[model samples]
Target: MAGEPAVTPVPTDDELVVVPLRHWWRWVGGAVILVLLGLLGWALADAKIDYAAVPGFFTHDIMLRGLVNTVVLAVVAQAGAIVLGVVIALMRRSANPVARWFAAGYVWLFRGLPVLLQILLWFNLALVFEDISFFGIWEEKTNVLVTAFVAALLGLGLNESAYMAEIVRAGLNSVDHGQVEAAKAIGMTPATALRRVVLPQAMRVIIPPTGNNFINMLKGTSMASVIGFLELIHAANNIASRNLQIMETLLAAAAWYMVVVSVASVGQHYLERYYGKGVAR
Candidate 1:
């Protein structure tokens, strides 16, 4: 027994104590109650209530256009946010103290402010400047759509960049200092080392959270409606008010939103899985 491994006898299956379902009857009874409640709801809402006006309302030009606008706004805003977020993330991690400070401050201020207030402030920014000229292109007017869309994009993108900076920074920091040192040991510059060694590894952490943020930004695009951007919710509100089928129209908007978010969720899940392969490091 001096160096021998200890051996233990395996127990029989019968020795295991398995708890039976004492609440089986409770579950059955609850299921029955739920079925009855559903039946009652169907009889009242689906059977008797009329939804004849819904198709007519939904098919209207305004609602269709509004839905289109919502899609466009979400896409554009997300694109801007992603690009700006990466830029901010890079700047925050820069070697210069001034660059780091300015990037950090931008993220802090925007993240701290309410998005609605940010949108409103942007819509009114034209009042202060009169006109914004970019590369000799002067904005002809400070119109509601232009102002509101710009404001919403800036507000959401800037706010999102702050949060993204933290995510990106975390991803970048997740990389081992040894990798950077190793790269330099092989004659790589800091920038080249980051590009070839650090960023690829950091992406495992960076991508999943950024996808979630993009989904959130898609939903947040609705805030643009406040400044007269005729997005889905705004259109639904208008349709419901004029026709008095408020519940139905609101429900329709909710349905569309649910569909969009659900699809985004599926995509996010797959992306997470794809990016997660490197996480064991």
Candidate 2:
């Protein structure tokens, strides 16, 4: 106030101050990454591959047939896996030691085995069992299992059941124990309680991961190619080999896979949102 230059306002704790900060190194790293990505894209574009073959893939009857087969295989295999998975999950959660052990052994064996190896094993199951008889009246040769569709379904479905069992168990575990007890107190049978009370809640936990698994199963169906199942990749392989446009055919197949995956992703998002309705946590 006296002899001091007019006092300037000092920033108080309540006043906001803007401080500009720069991380030059982070910017440099980002630039470098962008440059590398650009180069990679350019290289792919200029690569010595028959890009012309890719567009024709949409019109090719073989490709369309393979796509249909892939879709069918995915649906059938996933359906079987879901049923088997639920059963195994129930067994795993059972009070009986025998049932638990059986479920554990199944999960261990299937989860431990590589899916490719499992496919091969199922394909050659005829060597182990000469015939697969359903009943005295209904019988079939084990060789029947060697077919591409049968081999792929058995391998993928059985293998997926192991993963699904774990997933379902996790979902079941998410349910509150009190709910089960309450259901029992109300005189509902265990089966009725699970179906009516616990499962609905558990679905919130189950739907998202299960949707992801479905997508994975969709892609896994491509492996049926090894056994002459003319699924998408197998069909592409045949075309590529014949035309000597390996890269283009593969890219085409990859494009179709991406399209299917995108569609599945959209479906999963909606399903997750629906099931996640009441349970936002």
Candidate 3:
């Protein structure tokens, strides 16, 4: 008895094993999806659609340039929107009444306006703030020209900021209040507590929605074409007009958009997963 080691007893079959119940709808759904996919593939490969024209889609200079411009617009606008959103979110959350009011007003004003009207407004904004003068002594023309590119950037970025502000504020608020208290207990300043404690924890909740916004912004960039900002859709329109292959050109643009969105989705998946780790911690 002194030399013997203790051993735990194993559970019986009823205690150890658990079985799932069968669901008939899952099988039906799988079969339906497979049948639909088969039909789709067959229809696409049929001679009615000219899949051959796809290769020529990128050969034209207009489409290429439009794609480049779209990429540049999306990247620049999203970056600017994200930075502005963070500042606005912080202001919205600030204890200072003035900061809170200004932030709230900004979000309300921008979010209330339609994006198209906003684009047109910024495009024609030069009519109002055309001149800059500190006093009556000296004056210079303001540099906010509503060029096609500038109009699209300002419209998209500013509009995006309002939405991003809400997203960021939601994320910030989702962080545990106790963490802030703990940070303060350790003598961390408000700014330091936010940066070191709140924001990092908040990112997990922030990333997924932010990714959805980015994807929407990518699509929104196409709206820039209305103001003569030659992004992918506009490029396709130009090429379609010139070549008379309207369907093909538009289809090509659609394909490209899908591809870009798909890639963004993949990136978002990884980002959510990465931040998911932090949330777990």
> TM-scores across all candidates?
0.78, 0.90, 0.84
The lDDT of model 3 is 0.89
lDDT of 3 by residue, 1-281 (tens): 78899888989987887778999899999999999999999977874656788769855688889888988899899999999999999999889999999999999998999988898888877688997677899876654445889889999999999999999999999998999999999999998999999988899888999999999989999999998889999999998888788878888898889888999899999998887885465
- Residue 99, candidate 3: Cα error in Å is 1.3
lDDT of 2 at 76: 90
lDDT of 1 by residue, 215-239 (tens): 7877887898888878878888888
How many residue pairs in model 1 have overlapping backbones?
0
- Evaluate residue 177 in candidate 1 and report its C-alpha lDDT on the 0 to 100 scale: 93
- RMSD in angstroms, candidate 3? 6.7
What does candidate 2's lDDT look like per residue over 1-281, in tens digits?
Answer: 78989878988987977788989999999999999999999998898976777889755788889988988988898889889999999999999999999999999999999888999889889889998877677888888646878999999999999998998999999999999999999999999999999988888888888889989988999888888889899989888878888778888888888888899899899988887888675
Instruction: List, in order, the clash count of every candidate structure.
Output: 0, 0, 0
Candidate 1 wrongly placed segments (more than 4 Å): 1-60, 134-146, 279-281
lDDT: worst 10-residue window of model 1: 137-146
lDDT of 1: 0.79
- Residue 91, model 1: lDDT of 88
